[model samples]
Target: MQDIAREAGVSSKTVSRVSNGSDSVRPATRDMVLAVMDRLGYRPNFAARALKRGRFKAIGVAMFDIVATGNLLTLEGITKAASDLDYAVTITMMGKGQQRSLAAVVERMKNLPVDGVIVILEQMLPDVGTFVPPAGMEVLLVTSAQSTTMSTIDEDQYGCSTMVTNYFLDRGHRTVHFVSGPEESLDSHFREQGWIDALARRGVVAPPVIRGDWSADSGFNAGLELAHVKDCTAIYAANDNEAYGVMQGLAAAGKRVPDDVSVIGVDDVLRNLIPRLTLTSVKMNFGAVGRRAFRMVARAIEDPQRSRPTRELIPGVLVERSSVRDLTR
Candidate 1:
């Protein structure tokens, strides 16, 4: 520190302030000190800093799958927010099926050297009672279920699902059919419930849900079946990939979108590639969920006793496009 200060012709205090990112230092002096440090290849000792601050300056994120579009986007948001807050994120992916349990994952994360932890719920856990966090460990959840023990952040899946379905029903469609995600997914659960609730409110019975594995291929198969159902005029898919596959299947079956049938989906993905398709979708603010989760975890870490369990719901908006036909028009 003193060497850099001497070389930059500044006091040691000025160099220290610059290195610590303090705004008290003059801009020119801070620039000069940074240049000197860069030229000298000076690196701050993270271990020493952590010891002094009593924090690892890092957070751990545990998830079952990272390849899913929604999970990937949420992770991106987490990474961005953590970087902005000067915290590092360590990601751990738990394998699918019986390879791991929620209790096991929570225990493993407790052993890690992170100041806090965020759990991304990709599937329904067997028992929520067994997934308790250790004392003093800050924890957050991103799931559809309302949590009473930890801070939870999620997109309002039920409301968005109902909104899209109601949009179709109001357009003179007798009823809205659904393409659902995996049976074990909480998102699929809430979205399907929302669809059913919307129909029930209108005194109409909902059609049997067509199940998909969150893949375009599964949606294609479901679409093939719906194509044959002459009364299936409106379809609401759980996500955008499924909607794309449904569109392809409809085209192959000699059905025209918004003419013979209208299609709507959640997750406005791949909009640039298929602009002509103009698929209407429910757009989720996944970035907001991630940022809020991080903030909650940070608060817990700062004062665990004062931080109470809170639920944050990020709402999705309906993006209008050419996919759905307005029969009233």
Candidate 2:
């Protein structure tokens, strides 16, 4: 303290005031003290700084992987938001084939000096409830991983499912079969429920539901099963990948799209835009999901005391294409 005071030609109190951004320091005196501290490479300890100001100025992000398009967009959204707010971000990438356990990641963050964490949703990974967050630390769940106290943000999966299913139903289809994702996934269940609800609304008994693991292969298998059902005139797939597989299966079985059977899926992937044979689907602004989650986490970090944990939903829009027969015509 005395050394810095001597170097800056100022008193110890002036150095303290300048370092803490207190109002008492004169402009010239503050500059002199800052210059001396810089020359001496005197960095403030973050822990001590946090104690003085009640903020760590850092946030943690835990994602399943960066390769997935949705996760990548989420990462970008988080980074952009953090940069705009002048906050430092530390991102931890989970494993490739085997998911990195949330327990281990949360433990690591607990020991670090970061203020909060934002976890990207991964259905293959186990529930996040196993990992206990640090006392007073904010944790935001960006996906459907369950947490008793964490703030959560997700797309309106059920709503999307209902919109597409109703569209098919309104077209005068006798029954619409569903190709769903894994049973364990929250989105999958919500979507399936929506399909069931839509059928119930029309006083029609819901048809048997085929489960997929959110992959093209599963959709293909489910499609083959649907082809044999003579009454199956319409199909609703979980995602675009599954929809593509369903198309292949229908073609191999000598059935034409919209002519023989109509189809609808969710997630408007880039490849779905190809004009040759456009697959009608429900479009989701995944980037918005990421941005909303990031903002929620940021807000939670800033107002840890006054903010209450909340769950936010992003809506989806149905994109009409040639995949459906337009039975009304």
Please give the CA lDDT of all the candidate structures: 0.85, 0.78
Candidate 2 accuracy as TM-score: 0.78
Task: List, residue by residue over 204-307, the lDDT tens digit for candidate 2.
Answer: 78888888887888888888888888878899998888887887788778778879988888888745355675798888777788677767877877877776
RMSD of each: 2.6, 4.5
Candidate 1 at 239: error in angstroms?
Answer: 0.8
TM-scores for all candidates: the values are 0.89, 0.78
Candidate 2: how large is its RMSD?
4.5
How many angstroms is residue 197 displaced in model 2 relative to the true structure, after the best TM-score fit? 2.0
Q: What tens digits encode model 1's per-residue C-alpha lDDT throughout 1-329?
A: 99998999988988877877679998988888889999999997666666666777789999988988888889889999889888899999887554566677777776777888888987777755446677767778898787667778899999998899889889888899999999989898999999999999998899999998778888788888899997899999999888888888888888899798899989887676675658899998887788888888987887777988888788899999899988887
Q: Residue 235: error of model 2 in Å?
A: 1.1
Candidate 1 runs further than 4 Å off = 1-36, 97-99, 127-130
